[model samples]
Target: MLKKLYLLPLCLIFFVPLIVCEKILILPDHLKNFWIAGVNFDYFSYYKSKVLLILVLFSLISLLYRLRKDEISIKSSKLYIPLFVYLFFIIMSTIFSKYKDISLWGFPDRYEGAMVLFSYIIIFFVFALVPKIKDTQIILNSFLISSFLIGVISMLQFFNLDFIKSYIVGKLHIFQLQYLGKVYIKFNPGPRYVYATLYNSNYVGSFMAISFIVTFILYVLNNEKKRIIYGILSVIMFFSLIACHSRAGILGVMVAVIFFAVYKYKEILKNFKFVAPILIIYLLVYVFINTLSSSYIGNKIESLFVDINKTITNSTNNNLRDVKIYNNAVCLNFDKATLNFVFDNEKIFATDENNKRVSFKFDSNKNEFLFENPTYSQLKYFINNYNNMPVLILNNGYDNLNLIKTKEGFKILSFSGKINNINPVDKIDVKGKEKLGSGRVYIWSRSIPLIKNTLFLGYGPDTYALYFPQYDYIGKFLFLGTPSILVDKPHNMYLQNAINIGVIGTLAFLIFILCYLIFSFKAINTLKDSSLSTISISIFFALIAYLVAGVFNDSVVYVAPLFWALGGLNFKILNN
Candidate 1:
């Protein structure tokens, strides 16, 4: 019974990705409002947490039972110190948080608060304590199988397997066809990007990126026939990764490959004949996929270069010209300079050198500005004070603007407008033409300042959204079309941690990760068992890829557990 109980957690681990892939299996309106830990009691996250909690409890019970019989011995490692310290800080941060509920349970939108953190810690300890080679194999096999299923489904989606897509969508009613919106551009619309079972294509890419490395490592360790099979799986996952069209994912895989090569230079040289065939196969598959979808893939790659070049040469000149204001039955043309204050069709106010308020009435018939006390100086002041309004002064064009007063300063609220040909600026709506890092540069620039104020203790876990608004000036200008868009977390995971849990917490977390990596790599270097060493190195490479991708993306519910679980399994293998 105790042995069987251990299998339950492993089953739950595999079950997670399957349900998450099917879009969280959200409940209906009446049932959706049911809350747990302050988050909506959905099937995916809620059930997964419950299962993990049960697993933790069962593992504890089993441990106690074994302890009484003297069947097991407690083993300690260097990792426990930093891990416990990090958990301590997590508790302290949550307790002292201004929003304790949110800190403890996470925000309703993304439940990754103290509770989830606790669950992750529980999972880590469970694996670390088990210290069984067979258990480690079970976890790795489960991961690979789940990942393979995801890869196959994503490939089918990419090929427009409508029956499969329809079946999955029908089963998971939460899956929306138009979820991509502005993120992905569909030129022909068979399926521009494949999200597979993940929330977004980038997420699918992140998953596939890790899977690719794992599958390749399995191929490397397997015998002749098994190597051939694993090699095919690796190729399939690589293609699926490309289908996701995630530049960050591709970049991460490249980085991992470089790292692996540098680390295993001797092994590569010794096994050149084995590696060369896999490389050739990879190249052929790449060419075939690229050729099959030349317009989509080729254009995407080409646009990347164009966007990079544009960012380098793009000037920040004022391109807000031919500004048109419409009120009642009147339309008036104003130069980029001649817009002092625009308050969303409610009012227009401008001030002169004498601190005199100038008011303008729109003439319906004339379609021009009618000043109460018209003068050249007043007109000049109106133009000169254009900067005073909360309008976005893009180098490309002007957008309909609204002003809102905040504690910091005047913030812009923009409405969608078309860019004129005379002075067109690159708007954010032109999908695939975004600046490098997908506007992360601007987001990070605004977000970095908040860390100084909350250096010791942060706002709270999963409370980055609370502080995001104050630093969202660039977001407003960039996403003029989507005014309601809110960036809760900085794209970078490290930055998100720093903002949410403070510098000390972030440092502790980093220490834990570094220690895990150090220990795992050391084990891999010294292990005599080829299969064990290969698996260890594989997990390390996958983690490296994930971390590399994380530099451009924050941790999500779908991926974070997988990372932590795999890390824990590494610890288990090391101990064994």
Candidate 2:
């Protein structure tokens, strides 16, 4: 029975490929289009849940078979305290939740507590059971092969290679061509980007970032022959990353690179005399190739490096073009610029019916600008009579809604053409007023009051969004950006977990991160094997990258390939 353990690795190799194949097999159809569900299967349909249940059952059966045959030890304990906390919250949440029915199970819009619980459990299981280092190799090999195949396909699509396209289209029924499909010709001469088995460019960027880190780690450990092969793949991954045009993904990889340098700080200095010139040559080569690339690449690089301070003084428009300029310019002068633009520009200028001043706001980011009219804008016609005396002129100078100075000593604008007696700016109108303008700091601020309510057992997983609005704004800006957008999950994962299961859950999650850090640090110290050391170090760096990136994006909340890579590595480290 113990001998069968060897077969387990082979099974994993095949199993990993099968998963990859499943993704590839569905690509042509799912990649091009999206659907809610089948005609018979509506929202919160049982189909996806049933499939997950089957997989869980199969895994359990496999474990039992191994245990009965004495092929594997099924030693287990309450090893997942953090997960247990999450489960605890789910149950607690069932009682106080405004939407308990949806919270306990699945929702019409998205997954419920039970489904999220399983995601946590499955991840924890994979981390605890999957063996170290070897499993990482299997995953990496699968990624490399899968990415290469997809890259080849995208290239074939690029040249209008009709026969190949038709052959693939026929094979994959769902895939249709529109604007060069996954690999746009604008990026390069061939398949410039690798959408791979994912639907969106952002996913492609994320996958490439993780794969590139893996390739770099592998290259550092590879023999001469392997080095050449992996090195070429690394270059391919780099181009693929650039083609995705995902700023967050690029930032994530950059963080990983910085971590790599920091991890090797001592070694780097010790060998600086020998390594300095080699590093210089690599930099030179990279720059030379970048220079020869398309104008788009050159422009993007230039845009990345442009000085923000010099650009902000030149503009006031808040359209996408203006916003990009402003975003770059405000990099150094955010607060001052926002204030000047707001107050000086009369960003909130409106007039009441009695000719009193009302309020409004101007918000701009990238291509999106929010011009919220609390009151005044230009009227359609000139000053003709007192009856039509009031008008609104937005910064763009358009009057769609009625703005009036009322005799009731208040300035008001009816969202509709006709006036409504109800006041829209009442305290009840807004959400999360107490924590407004604080961004992620709202989580910390709001948590203090919530903990007083339930010190031992708190709210539930994903409960932050519902409770946050109870905290009113603090007379500043509205929560309009990153932290506010991610109100779905608390901006801080630690705080979110803590609020859900009280202090215990929060501590457990921290301990897991701490444990992984300590173990990886020790591995770096004791392992004289360069290959093992490089991979371990890279994994450590990648984890940090994800954490930092999470500050701005809801990464851990979603199941991206990066999470899988990180979990697999953490599992490997503990087992090793």
Candidate 3:
């Protein structure tokens, strides 16, 4: 029974990547984010619910053995300290959380991070209980098999069979592009990227990067014949990452390669005699691949900075550059209206169609308009005239101008921008969508002050939506063009932590990262054994790459198998 239970995790591991495409009905519909698993027999809804069921089973196991105290091991001790610290901070923050419920149990009360942490605890405790390297091999093998399958399936999706997307969506996916009665799995962006059951290409890129590093490390562990197989796997993972077209992931791979070279310098440098021939062969191979490909892969690689500025503008009906320009114009008009309010002693109360008031006044003493400052006059001399329109429009579109009078105030017009015909107070109904996808730019801009306000304790988990308006929802006038009227998660994880948990969580989180780096570095440094050294080096560099990528984007979090795998690997080294 114990062996069977141990094998259970491995069993699920094989199915993790495959289960994402299966059909299942969800209870609340919003539980879908965590449900974006790969192809599987079970529907996403079933898998999500099953995670809870598995948690219950594990909880029972913990309870049944709660009275039976097992001897502690070196690995468990090292792992538990950090785990406990994370939990302690989370619990303490929750008590003081403006969003107490989410802080304790996750936003939907599912405890995704806690579940991940629990899984780590289970693996560590089981390792201590069993004290077997064979168990570690089981988990690693499962991951290797799943990653191989995922790579193959992702390649198939790039072929655009339409069957894959159809089978995955289970229903008619209107969001997916349909061409010639077939659902095309390419974004409208130039050179169209494929997002296989994954929500974004970046996710695919990150997954591939980690998989490549693991495979490379495994290749290092293998004997001659097995090394060839792992070598092929590395190539496949690298190709898949390139196909994803994630610049950050590509940069991460380069970082890993550089780290590998520096760490393995002596071993590689020993073959200095054949270096010139190897370099010549590599150049020839690169040229051959570039010439053979029909896709502009060579050109794209050469010109990484594809001017997406034209992309946004060309898509919009108006001369305005794109959705960004439109959004900024709205913000611009709102800011101007706010100034009108202050000067005339009129209170500005602009809202969306929903009648939710959107404007707020900043502290008058510190946050004054630029025009009110003496510097504005000097700066204005460089340009024809300085207008306080939303920054979005002036930068992207809104070249021509006119003015009109409304019941509330004077309305400015620009021929190059879309006309604002609808009442500014009417809400445009932008709820429950990816508010912005240009990545962390807007979040960094808006979340700074919120972080400062909660300098010590933060507003609490999931309180950004409630408090964002209090700071800078600035109506439709200022034209900052932030996506949603009701702002939520601050996009960046670091900012989100500072805003939700306050100074303590930020410090603790940073400390956790610091400990991870220091321990991994120490392990790598102490490596006398070749296999141990390789594994430690790979794991350390992979963590570095993951952290670098994660700073700009959200990650797999605790529920992700990668998290558990990494945690288990670190614990093994600490114990060893």
Model number with the top TM-score? 1
RMSD of each: 9.3, 11.1, 12.1
Each candidate: how many clashes? 5, 25, 26
Ranking by TM-score: 1, 3, 2
What's model 3's TM-score? Answer: 0.62
Which pairs clash (backbone N, Cα, C closer than 3 Å) in model 1?
21-197, 337-383, 338-383, 396-424, 396-425
Candidate 2 clashes: the total is: 25
What does the lDDT read for residue 528 in candidate 1?
Answer: 79
- Give the alpha carbon lDDT tens digit for every residue of 1-576 in model 2: 563353243233212211211112121231122221111112112333334344444544555555677744534434455456545555665556555544454432223254544544553454345433455555546556655554444333323342333433443444324323552211122333333334334445555566666665555545446666666666566656665554445667788877776767676566565446544644554465455454454555454334222233333322111111121111111211221121112133323333344343333332122334412121111111125433321122322222233444222233224342322221222222232212444444444555555455556544555555422311112233211122445545456555554665556556656665665666566766566666666666666655544543342322232354355445554445
> Which portions of model 2 show Cα errors greater than 4 Å?
1-57, 74-87, 90-96, 100-114, 130-136, 146-206, 245-247, 265-459, 462-504, 527-534, 556-570, 573-576
lDDT, residue 318, candidate 3:
16
Task: State the C-alpha lDDT per candidate.
Answer: 0.63, 0.43, 0.47
TM-score of each: 0.73, 0.55, 0.62
- Once fitted onto the true fold, the runs of candidate 1 whose alpha carbons sit more than 4 angstroms away are 1-5, 20-69, 162-190, 292-294, 298-434, 470-474, 479-481
